[model samples]
Each structure stands twice: as C-alpha cells, then as structure tokens.
Target: MNRRVKEGTYKGKKFNAICHFFGYQARGSLPSKFDCDYAYVLGHVCYHILAAGLNGYMATITNLRNPVNKWRCGAAPITAMMTVRRWSQNPGTASIGKPAIHPATVDLKGKAYELLRQNATKFLLDDIYRNPGPLQFDGPGADSKAVTLCVEDQDYMGRIKKLQEYLDKIRTIVKPGCSQEVLKAALSVMASVTEVLSVMSSSPINGQSSL
Candidate 1:
C-alpha cells in the first residue's frame, strides 16, 4: 500500500522485462539470465526461477510459454532493506543502502562498462529513443519483477551441483506425465525446505539465522 512499495516494485519489474525482452530478441535464446550477478539481470532470472519453479511445481510450464503469467503480486516491506538518515552536507534525510551508487565500484562493473563505451554513441545519444517506462499492471509486461530475492534452498555451489539433479527430478513430476495439482504442492514443499539460511558473516551471529 505504500508509495515506495509500488514505485520500487514497478521499477524492478519494468527493468527486468525490458532487459530480458531485448536480450532474447537479440540472441534468439535465454541463458545467463538464470544466473546473472548484476542486480538488474539477476532480478529477471530470479523471477523466472520463482515463477517457473512455482509452475513446474504446479505442473504448468505452459504458463512460461505465455511469458506473461509469472507476475509477482506482493511487495516486500521496505523497512527490511532500507534506513533513513540525516546528513550535514544536505539538511534533509536520505534513504541509503546497497542500491545507492558508489563511485569507487565503477571499475568493478568490468565488461558491462565496456558495453557503454562501445554503444555510448547510440545509448547515450538523443533523438533515437524508446522508453517502455514502468509497465502497466496488465498485459504481457505485468508478470516479472526486478527485485532479487535469495530463496536459499540450496547453496550456490551446491545448487549448481544439484541443479541438474533437481531439474531431472522436477521433470518427472511436471510436464505430460504428472498432474498439475500435485506439481504445485511439490514445488511449494521443495522451496520451503530449501530456503536460504540467514547467514550473517558480518555479525557475531555468523551462521545462525537472524531473528
């Protein structure tokens, strides 16, 4: 219900949809989308994982065929990831967190920085333009979100090892051989059992789950 919830959610979803659509349109395939490290790229891939996994659980990969059936309807509480603070340089309060840009990390973007250099004439140029804007909460664009959630069912390295195993296991329960009703139940159960642990290496809690 909060304005930030709507804005943040809309911003995240629109960014992902446009990014994936353009990528797929260009490459005629979609991979790396499954495990992009960039926040924006990762968000799209995560939604696919969530939606597809949910559907595969539901025995309905057909929804993915539509590419518009995976819309996430809930908004995470903004408080969980943000804080407001006052600063002397500017008299107003500011919301600060990992989302804020840092000049120091510019070089870390690596190849992505290269893309801008190569395409700056086109990307940074004016006149030739297309802005899809925040997608309307209806139609094909409404489905995915840019927000990246770490579900943590399996460890990153562990999951890569087991993804093939799990993918195989899921195929049997989903698709033509199994019932959709049962698949939904299966996916939900698996996701619940495999939630990412709240490991805070920065704090004393370390491996323990934060309350």
Candidate 2:
C-alpha cells in the first residue's frame, strides 16, 4: 500500500511508458540500469510461503503482495475476519457482526498464526514486521533503533512504552480490582501519553513549525 501510494500518477506513467516501449526488465529487456533488490531473498521464501495447501492466498499475478492461496498465511483479528462484506446485495443471512466461534477454529488455536500473534517485538523493518508508527508525523516516535527520533523523542517513546504496558495490564485485571494505585496509574498513563501525542500532532517540516 505504501509503495502504491508513493508511486503516484507520474510514477505510474513512467513505469507504464518504460514497459510499453521496452517491456519489463525482468523479461530480459531494459532501457538503462535498474536495481530491484529486495530484503529477504525471494528465492526460498517464495517456495514454501507459496507452496501447496494455500492456493487462494497467492495473488502474485494480480500485482498483489503475498499470494493468498494454499501454503502461506497472513491474518487479521477474528473480529476483523468475521466481517464478510456483501458485494452486490445478494445474501441469504447477512452477518455483519463477529460470528460465534465454531469447533474447527478452536482445534486450530495453537497453530503458527496464534503463536505468531503472541510473539512480541520491539523493533521493525517492514510492515509485516513493524507498523512503523502510523506513517509518522502523526504519533509518537518509533521505538526501533533504525527509526530516527523526533520532537520530545525520549519523553515520547518512554510514554508510549508505558502506554502499551498499561493497556496489556488492563486486559488482565478483570477480577474486580479495587486497587486505587493501579487505577490511578492507568489514568496517569493515558494523560501523559496524550500530552506527548498532542504536541507531536503538528508535523515538523525541516524543523519549521506548521502554522
């Protein structure tokens, strides 16, 4: 999605013109020099991640990333997955909300997808590995070393880490907690994080403020 967005009308026209005259360089024809180096050698990754038993996931032909076929898999939440959108108003039972979980899903609970979800990371290089802080200029700085820090850098990332931990804590405190200290901590976390984000809400362009 980021690549597509970056390649606007002008970029699209350039690629189309080049292909129209000389054809894609991958087809053994090119105009000048083209360096198409991608991280993670596509050789072995494609074979297994695109192997049997996952046909619908492989959408390579449509210029779509990650073929949605047999072997490879990507995932969204069950709540997000539960959304089966209607196309042309042709549905028997229009299910809009999350459906009741079935037995088959429960059987596949401990699989790689679930395990992958539980595996947390503190750095990232790609969208698959990292969300990259929501396209930046809009939120707290990324915690990754690779990402350059912005305004209030230390205070921002610090508050963000605390916010994430606090949210996780909220998930575990379902047993009617009367601990005022914990309650206050959660509220303080919210206030502090919001303050950082609010200041960062203005995009800094070459160290100049956006009036």
Candidate 3:
C-alpha cells in the first residue's frame, strides 16, 4: 500500500513521495462523544456479565443508534464468534491454527460501499472534502451519528418485534388457569422482554441503569 501511494500516478500527474502513518496519534487523542458512550455501556455490560458468573463469553451492546439506555445488552460465546486462522508460533516452530476474532471489514455489497463505488470516479479527481468538525455533545452534528449503528438497530428491532408478536399470540392462546410451571416460565420470559423495553424507553443521561 505504501509503495503504491509513493509511486503511483493518477491521470497524467505524478504523486509526491511521502509516507506518513497516523494510527498512534489518532489512538492517543481524546475520546469523541460516540466513543465515550460506547465505552461506558460496554464496561457496564461487562460488569453485568461478570456478576452473572458467565465465562467464555464476550459482552456486547447493540442498537447504539438509539440512546445508551436503549442499547441492547447480551453475551456471546467467544469461540462462536471466532474463526480459525493459521499463525506461526515462532521462527523455529511449525505454524499452528488458532481461533481469533478478526477485525471487521467493509462489506462490498452494502449500501455504504455501493455508494462509494458509484462515486469513485468523482472522488478520485475532485478534491472535495467534508470537514465533520469536532465531535459535539449536543446539536445537529450529535444527531447525525453512525449509519452502521442505525442499520444494525433496524435489523435487530425487526427480529425482536416479530418475537414479541409471537409471545403476545402465545399469551392470548394460553388459558388463565394454566399450570403454575407453565405460567411461571411465561411470566419470566415476559418480564425479561419488559425489562429490555423499559431500559429502551428510559434515558441514560437521566441516570437510568442500562442492562
């Protein structure tokens, strides 16, 4: 990548040769609003998982497009989310396969990438730039958040809404005089759903505890 950037020419113009890496500087900067909220909720979720005595699991909070309170908390088995990859143990040792969580990549078929693909020509030649400016806590820019979060939230909500409807149907069909065990199980499930919704309805900024 560096070689291409240093030697490549676009159109009829030759590019200047300068290689700079900004990863360290960017990583050392102060957290943005999104970063702060995301980290806080993730930490809270991890605490809950630990308190629940869960092991070999990763804490996650989804639906981040919504407020922190609305974020959905869940735990996923680490192995379930990882893939096996070949890695060298040492220079003298043989390579071994290891399970690892790889960094996520942009989906070529996704809308975001598709839009970028469509505008590639324009972006290559036109020196158009958009300054997002500093991250804000309140106002118009704050409202304009990550598109990925919104997309994930929409997908999650759709599935959850369907499950809720199924649960409601089951409730309607079940008799009022159902067995104690059955009623207890149903109530437990209902309570769990209600708790999630209650959390969603409250505001994290108002000191409401998020699951």
Best by lDDT: 3
Candidate 2 vs. true structure, TM-score = 0.24
Q: Is candidate 1 or candidate 2 better by TM-score?
A: 2
Scanning candidate 2 in windows of ten residues, the lowest lDDT window is 30-39
Task: Return whichever of 1 and 3 wins on lDDT.
Answer: 3
Q: Candidate 3, 125: how far from true, in Å?
A: 5.1
TM-score to true structure, per model? 0.22, 0.24, 0.52
Question: How would you encode candidate 2's per-residue C-alpha lDDT over 1-211 as one tens digit per residue?
Answer: 4477577634433342233554555577322111121112333445655564444332211111211232232322343222222233456765343233222333234444454455435224334634423333224432222221111123333455687897787768723565878778777977998899878655433333333
- Give the Å error, residue 72, model 2: 13
Model 1 segments beyond 4 Å from truth? 1-68, 83-114, 124-127, 131-211
Q: How far does residue 131 in candidate 3 sit from its true spot (Å)?
A: 5.2
Give the Cα RMSD of candidate 2.
22.0
lDDT of 1 by residue, 1-211 (tens): 3575667744433332233346657866332232222334335655865775443221111112122334222223333333323224455756232222112335434555665576678866656422255534455544443322221121233345477898797777677667778878887877765663322322322122222
Give the Å error, residue 203, model 3.
Answer: 42
* lDDT, candidate 2, at 152: 14
Q: Write the residue-wise lDDT of candidate 3 on 83-128 in tens digits.
A: 5565576787876765566446777887777767888999999876
RMSD in Å for all candidates: 19.5, 22.0, 17.0
Q: Candidate 2 or 3, higher lDDT? A: 3
